[model samples]
Structure formats: C-alpha cells, structure tokens
Target: MPSVNPPRGMRDLLPADKARRERVLATIRERYRAHGFDEIETPVMEDYVRLHAGIGGDNEKLSFSVLKRGLDAEAIAAAADDPARLADLGLRYDLTVPLARFYASHRAELPTVFRSIQIAPVWRAERPQKGRYRQFVQCDIDIIGDPSARAEAELLAATLDAVDALGLEGAVVRINDRRLLDWMLGHFGFSADERPGVLITIDKLDKIGVDGVVAELRERGVTPTAVDAFDAFLHRPQTLELRAFGEGSIRKALPEDAPDDVVADLVALGDAVGRARGIPAPYFTLPVQFDPFLVRGMGYYTGTIFELAHPSVDYSLGGGGRYDGMIGRFLGQDVPAVGFSIGFERIVDLLDAEADAAAEAIVLVHDRDLPPADLVSLKAALVAQGTRVRLEQRTKNLKALLERAAADGYTSFATVTAGQTAADLEVKPLS
Candidate 1:
C-alpha cells in the first residue's frame, strides 16, 4: 500500500479545522442574506473558451485545462498538437466570471437588479504559498442591473457590514477609480493606446517600488520627460489627499474635454464609503479611504476598484469593483454590476477559532462481548440528553484508546460490558 496525499495546493481539512472555517463562512452568508442577496452555486468547471476569455487578467494563465476524454489513438494524434482541440473545458479560476455566465444563461429567471451571494471554491494552477493556494474559497456578493453610483455605495455598505461581522481589526479598504487612472495618464501625455499598458505596469506599484516602475515605463518607451513629470506629481506628499480632488497636478492634468462630473462622482463615492465605515456593527471602525495609486489588475473593471488589506499582512485580502460590461459580453446587452469578494481562505488563515468541546464527547463500547443492542441504547440515551456520541470499537488497550480519543478531543467516555445495566456501566473522563 502507498501513502495517500492530496494534490498540490489542495488541502484536507480535519473535522475541527473544517468546523472553524464553516463558522466564518456562515457568518458572512447570513449577513449577505440579510442584505437581500440570494445565494447561488455554479459548477466547478466551465467551458474552456469562457475561462480563457481576456477579462480575468493574469488569471487566464492559471486555469487548469481538462483533457478530451475517451478519444481513439488516431483522433488523439490528430488533435494533440493544438491546445484548442485538446481540451474543451477548464476549472473556474474565480466566481465572478461564472456568475456572469450564469446570469447570461438564466436572465429570465432572475430579477433585473440581481443581488447574489456565492461562497465556493475556485481552482487555479499556481505555486502554493503560505496562505495562497491553487484551490481556495471566495465569498462574493454582487448587484447587477443597477447602473447608479448608488449600486457601488450599497455594495460597499454591505461588504463593510460583512467585514464588521468578521471582527478583524486594522483592516483598511483602499479605493481608486479606473476613470481616475485614465484621467491621470491622459494628463501625463500617454496616448490612449499607451494608457492601458502603462496602467498595467503601474498596477505593480505595491509589488515593485517607484524606481522599478520608472524603469519599466522607460523600458516600455515612455519618454523621460513624461515619466519624470508623472513621478514628480505622484510622489509628492499632497498627492495622497488629491486635495479637493481638483488641485495641483490633478487639476492641470484634467483634459480640457474631460467630463465635468467626474469630480462630483468621486466626492459622492468617497462620502458613501466613509459613511460605510461609520455603520453600526462590531469592528465597524475598519477604514475605507481613497487611494490614487490603487490599480486593480483586472481588465474587466470599468469603474471604481478597491483592495482590502490588513495593516500587518503584505497581500491584499481580495477586492472588486464595477464591471458594468462583463455580463454584457455573455448576454449581448449591457447590464450594470458591482461586487466585492472577501478572501475567505485568507480570512480563515488570519483569524483564530476554537473547537466545540461538547461536540467531541463520545461513547466508547470497550467490550465486543457486549450486545450490540446495548451499545445502540447507550448511544441513543446520550444523544437524547443533547450529547454528541461516537461508539468506539472494543480494544483490550483501554488506556491507549483513552489517550488517543482524548487527544482527538473526546472529553469523556462511557463504557458498557456484557450483561451490565446502564447503572453498572463505568463512565470515565478522557480529558
């Protein structure tokens, strides 16, 4: 016999560990439901074409393709050289894309402005790290068909409520609008063609510092004068505040033909999220502030994008924003959508949860010589008294069994022998 191990990046959660994780998920799910979001579940696998669509950003490369099964030798040889012909489906890398596909395929059954709650595992083929895994859970709530900034506000409010329920301290949500980046780049002399590529590079600011960004920009053929000017404005102390959001470089960079209401939209959103932090709940003090440097990597983000982070953790706890156009690609008509996903795996990793000691109590049937009916009666009795009980197989090594069961969280054990009444049974404390 060989040892059995889970695949890389996948993990087996023991009973205790699984219970703790489930508790965290349950809290969020309940909160989402209270906000009137309906729960949803999608398949683990999706059409390869949908999975490979360009909206997922770098996640496209991380999808695990499913091979064509049951092919004859001649057919396999004919298609083996072309990836498109080799695989028809792939494991979903995230829930958002699948949600879009679901809405597209089932629009008639859903309300116009659908508020949905989905908590499920998504797969990605990547190198596993301390907290990041190839397969992990994502807890998402989204609103579709409401194209107002109010949609963004509600999503932020509900998300903060869920986060408050999580009770994690010192977490902040840093936000920026995609339009904000576009306006900034247009001011810095980047051509419309060059802006996307430039923003993609700029998205690495947290990973690679200013110097690295400048070098990468230069490598991408952006002129020194433009880079220097952009760097000077971006690095200044006052940039963080963006002061009245219309001052200094941001003011000067504003294109003459720019939409006049962009500033107003920013102000409205800021006030809304600021008020979100003030909502009544435990740990509601977690901050949500504007960050001009935030460039969420997802190409599908058409408007505001925000990243949640703990002051102590280096990686983001997950983020999302308005992808008003994503679902339209599937349905052939545009719909408004905004969402925020809590990194369920990372949250479970960072938080501590205790096991339920009462649930671990057991009934150890130490004597096979005892009638099976007596064992059942004892277990039923214990359960009737609101006690969880597992009957252990008889073993001569009572001390060893007790030690093992105690270590495994059994607090106490009751033993029965042949011809012994319930009163004659010996009840022993295991822990």
Candidate 2:
C-alpha cells in the first residue's frame, strides 16, 4: 500500500489545528481591513513566460511550472535541452508578482493610490525543512501608485500594527534603501557592472560574516582595490546601537558620505510612521531600526527595503520593500509600489494554541437511540439562538469524545436523551 502521508513539503491540518489557524488568519484579516487595505485575490497560476520574468530575482528559479497538456513524446524530446519550453504556466512563488499582474490587468478600476491585502498560499519548489515548505501562505499588503516616503511609512505602520494585533510585540523592522546600497558600492570604488555580483556577496554578510564576504569577493576576482577598501571599512571599529528611528540615528549607522537626500527621505519615513502611530515629532520611539546592510534578496526592490525581526529568532519573521519599477514591466508605465509580507508559517509556528471558543459554542452529545432528525433539531434550536452547535453520537469512550469536542473549540457540552427538548438540555462548561 502507498504510504499514508501528505506530500513531502505539504501538510494536513487536523480539525483542531485548522480551527486554530483560521483564528489567527481571521485576526490578521480584521487588522489589515481596519487599516483600510482591501483584500484581493488572483489565480494560483500565471503564464510561464510571465513567471520567468527577470523581476522575480532568485525566486523565479524555484517556481513550480505546470507542464502543458497533450505533449507528445517527440515534443518532449525536442525540448529536452530547454526544459522550460515544456510548460506554459507556473504556480506563483510570491504574492508580489501576482499583484503586479493584477494591477496591470485592472488599473482603471482601482484607486490612484491603491492599498491591497492578499492573504493566500504561494508555492515554490523548495527543499522542505523545519519552518520551510514547498507551499505556504503569505499575508501581504501593498500600496500602488504612490511615490512618496508616505507610501513606505504606511506599509511599515500597518505591518507593525498587524504584528502587534497578533500578540507578537517587540518586533523591530530593519530598514535600508537599494539606492543607498548602490551608491555605497560606487563610493567604495565598485563599478556599476560589478555591483550586482558584489551585492549578492554582500547579502551574505550576516550568514558568512565580513571575512567570508571578502574571501568570496576575492575568489570571484572582484576589483582588488575595492575589496581592500571594503575590507578595511568592514574591520573599522564603530559603536552601533539598536536605536529608535531618527535622522541622527540613520546617518550615524551609515558611512560618513551617505547621500543627504536618502537620509532626509528616511528621516521623513520615520516621522511619517511615527505620526501615523500618534507619536509626535522630535521624539522618536518607534520600533524601527536602520540597518545599512539590510539587503532584501529580491532584485525587484527599487528603493527602501525592510525585514521584520524579533530578538527571539535569528531568522526574519517577514520582509518587503519598495518595488517601484515592477508594475511597469507589465503595464508599460511606471507605477510606484511598496509592500510588506508576513511569513505566515513562521508566525503561526511561534503562536500558542488558540483559546477555546466562547460560551455560545457547544456540542450536543446525543444518546444512540435518539433519532437523527430530533438531534439535528436540538442543535438547530441552539444555533438559532446565535450559538455554534455540533451533534455527536454518544461513543463508548465518553471522556475521549468530550475531550475531542473541547479541543475542537467547543466551550460547553449538553447530554441529549431520546425525547429531550431544547429547554430540557442542560449545558455545562467543559472542564
């Protein structure tokens, strides 16, 4: 017999687990909607050509392509050298790509500055491991057609609020700008042609440390003078703090000659976010931090990038950034955009079991002799009273049945006899 298990990287949630996950998702939905983001959805598949578009960065390589139907042996053999030719569509690896396509498809109907909420599963052909999967849900919010720092600020504020609503406080957002990264590389004598490869190496700073990055750059035969200069800077002793977001803090965290305009924009971002959270200016106490080396891996990020961090976990809880140029690839015109995605699987893993349902929820444990229609009627009466009711036939293991009901989120239970009416039922809270 075939093994009874979900696919290698997929999962099967039991009733209790599903209920718990739904509760968390409900909270996230309510919070995002409260912040004025309207939920939207797109198909799970997109054209293979679109999925392979250069904007996806490394994620495009991991997309699960769907093979075209009705391919003959000859056709498959002809395309063996270029496997991608065998497929015409692929599952989306992230919400942002689908959102870009969505905006391009429905631009005229949306607001000039559209804020969208996308809570849906995305698939990638990832090697599954702890906290990583081939399929997972992403909670994403994006603002389209807004070029100002306010766009980025709104994204940060809303995302932080959602995280707070989920009862995961003390999460800090680390901010950076791709433009600053580019300029810093140039200032360190790296050419535009060499910057992409160098950024890939620099992105490994946290994983490999300063020496590892230097060693890799050297091995790659990057500019010798630039490597030495960067190495000296990396080894330079400097006091760094996890300070509140502010102009002084931002500049202090960067190299001495960091661009003034970018610094000013970042300061404005902090201020705007602060204002949104009702924190007055000149007093900076938001949970935002500036990390000059915070490079989000996606190549589509055109400006500000951020990652959600907590002191409790070495890995990021979530991240996103300004991808002002992505939509233009589909729409034929530039649309300023920024978004944040909460890593739902990671967040869910950190959450405690959901509390039992309130008193309005109850299970009707009917005697075996009770008619099915009568049992359903008893449940219907309770349900009509705005209660959640489930009818279960009395089992030999009474204790186990009640325990299962409680675990499934029922707060109370009532014993039902052959001719008992709704009023005759005595509901008692589950222990």
Candidate 3:
C-alpha cells in the first residue's frame, strides 16, 4: 500500500477541526465588520517578485516556491542555485503583502482609507511543533491609505475586541513603535545600518531572556559597550514608566520632542474610540514599561507594531504593524497600511482542550428502511441544527454502532425505526 500518512509538518483538518476553525473565523469576521472593516481576498499564489520585494526579515527564507517544468536545463540549474530565480510563483507567506500589492494595483477603485478583513491560508516551510504548522490560516484586518496615528489606535482597538470575542482570558496586546526603537538605537550610538540584526536579536528577548539577547548580540559582532548601552537604555525611567508619562516626559528624553505629542494623541485617540464604540475602558491597558528594544523583524513596518500573546501560551497568538512605504514600492505612491493576523490552529488547539472537558457523543442511526438520499438529507438537517451526527452503514448492528459511538464519546444518538417514515433523534447522557 502507498504511504497512508500526511506529509510531515501538515495534517488533515477533519470535521471537528473545521467546526472549531469556522467558529473562530466567524467570530473574527463579525467583530471586524462591526468595527467598519470590509471583507476582501487576494490570490493564494502570487508572482515571486511581488511577494519577495517587501517581505520582512527572516520570512524570505521560509517561502515555498512553485517551479514550472519545460524550462532550459541550464536555466533550471541556475534557478535552483539562486533562490531569487528558483520559482516565478510562491504560496503567500502572509496576507499583508498581498493586500499591499492589491492597493498598489487598484488604487483608483479603493477608497482613500480602505478598511478590510481577510481570512486565508498562508504557507511557510517551518519545522512544525505544538500550535505551529507549515500550512495554516491567518485572519487579517487592515486599514490602508490612512496616515493618521488614529488608524493605529483603531487597529489596536479592533484587535483587542476580536481576541475578546475569541473568549480567551488573560490576553495582552503588547504595543511598541518602530520609530521609538530606531530612535533608541541612534541614541545609544549604534548606526542605522546595524539596527536590523541587533533589533531582531533583541526582539527575541521575550522568548530568551536578557542574557540570551546579549549573547546573541555579541555573537553578531556587537561590541560590549554597545550591548551595555542598549541594555541600560531599555531600563531607563521613561521607558520603564511608559504608561505613566503623559506627554511632557516623552519630550524630555528625545531631542525630536514630537514623540510626546504622538503619545498624547494616542491617549486621546484611545479614549475617543472607547466612548464612540461603547467599549469598556478596562479592555485596553497601558502597562508601565515600554521597551524601545522591540523591533519586529518585518522590514516594511514603519509605525506602531504590536503582538497579541496569551499569558498561558509561550508563543504569540498574533501580530502586525503599520507599513507606510510598502504599497509605494509597487505603485509609485505612498499608501499607509496596518493589519493583525490570528493563528487559527493555535486558537483551535486551545478551544479543543477546553471542549474535551464537556465531551458529547453523537450517535448515527443506520436502518435498512432509510434510503441513501433520505440519510443525506437527515444528516444535513441535523448538522444545520448544530448537532454532530455520525453516519452508520447498513451493515452495522445497533449494539455495534452504539459501542463505536460510545468509544468516540458521543452521548446522543439519532436513528429511524423500522416502521417510521421520518427519523427519530434521542439525546442520551453518558456517565
């Protein structure tokens, strides 16, 4: 027999998986819609150039390329040697890049400030682990062509709302500004050219601790003084008490002086949005510490960037940021865009573990009198009514069927009797 298992790093999404994923997706879509974001989609496979041009940091290495046959052998050999030419098309790594390309290509059709939601699968050649898969769905919402910091505020609010809709407790939205990180780096004597590598290492601070970051930076050729300066800068009073500083404190730290004004604007924006939307003030919290060390590895992010992490989970649940220059790279005009993506598989894993405690078993009725067409109709109707119904083949006896359903943890059974024209459904509570 041929190999029966799925390829490594991928698995089949059975019916139960579909149910949980759909529930999460529906909740996200409804929440985003209520926040004034329209629904949109982009192609699954895009030209390699369009996808690669603006991809942030390490993602370029993870893309899964699709190559066409019948090309010259020498050309094929060369393409294989050079990643840039290996394939003309690739599975999309994330939704934001496609949205950027969409805005640039259809600038006239979209509004000045377009708000949209996209739920789709993205591919990466990653080593799979718990809650991490090579093929997974990303739910994204973005606002394009809006340069105001209010756009960032709105995106953050929508994110908070969407996760709350997911019913996850103790979720934190960690926010940081890319410009702040840049400023901090410049202030500490690291040149602009050296920021990316150092920042990427620092961004891993949450995963690995301060020592891990320092060690990684040293390995990357950063001098001891620079590392010490970076560490000390991260622990400054202004950085530590970010939530307490209103505007005046921000001005004192940087020569630019405008950061305080932006922080003030963000504070006001958060308040105005809460009042207008009738959202409770407690849903958004400004923790005291703001790390200027947080530089999300994405190259396109230019403004506010955030990560939504569950306190119980060691990994990030979702993350996104503003990319003002991304669309301009393709269309010759600057378009501001911001978005967030929720990992569908991670959410499902969390929900399934919870749902198992309230396990319910579904019983399928298989009788000789029920025709195939009728059985199909009955199964569809029961499913539409929010029931999980299993199908029974005619060969199975009631005792055997019941035994199987019991093993599957189904507590209820529905079936047609010998003389019955319509089906009879029964709920049986299991001990």
lDDT of 3 by residue, 75-132 (tens): 8887777766667899988888888888887879988899989899998999888777
Best by lDDT: 2
List RMSD in Å for every model shown: 4.3, 1.8, 4.1
- lDDT, candidate 2, 1-431, per-residue tens: 99999988999999877877888888889988988899999999999999998989999999999988999999999998885789999999999999999999999999999999999999988999998999999999999989999889888988888888888867888899999999888888898999999999999998999999999999989889999989998888877554568888777767787999999999998888888888776645788888888888899999999999988888999999999899999989899999999999999888655432444688888777779888888778888989989888889998999998888888888898887888998989887
CA lDDT, every prediction? Answer: 0.79, 0.88, 0.71
Task: Give the TM-scores of the predictions, in the order they appear.
Answer: 0.84, 0.95, 0.83
lDDT of 2: 0.88
**Best candidate, TM-score:** 2
| Candidate 1 residue lDDT tens string, 1-431 | 86598888999997656766777888899888887899999999999999888999989999999987887788879998887788899999999999999999899999978999989999988899789799999999899999888777787777778777877767777777898788878777788888878988898888888888888998999766778877876666543332322223334444345445665565566566655556432223436655667888888999888788887789999899999999999988888899999999887777744333336476666565667897788778777877777788868887887787666566788766765655575777775
Candidate 1 minimal-lDDT segment of 10 residues = 241-250
- Rank by TM-score, descending? 2, 1, 3
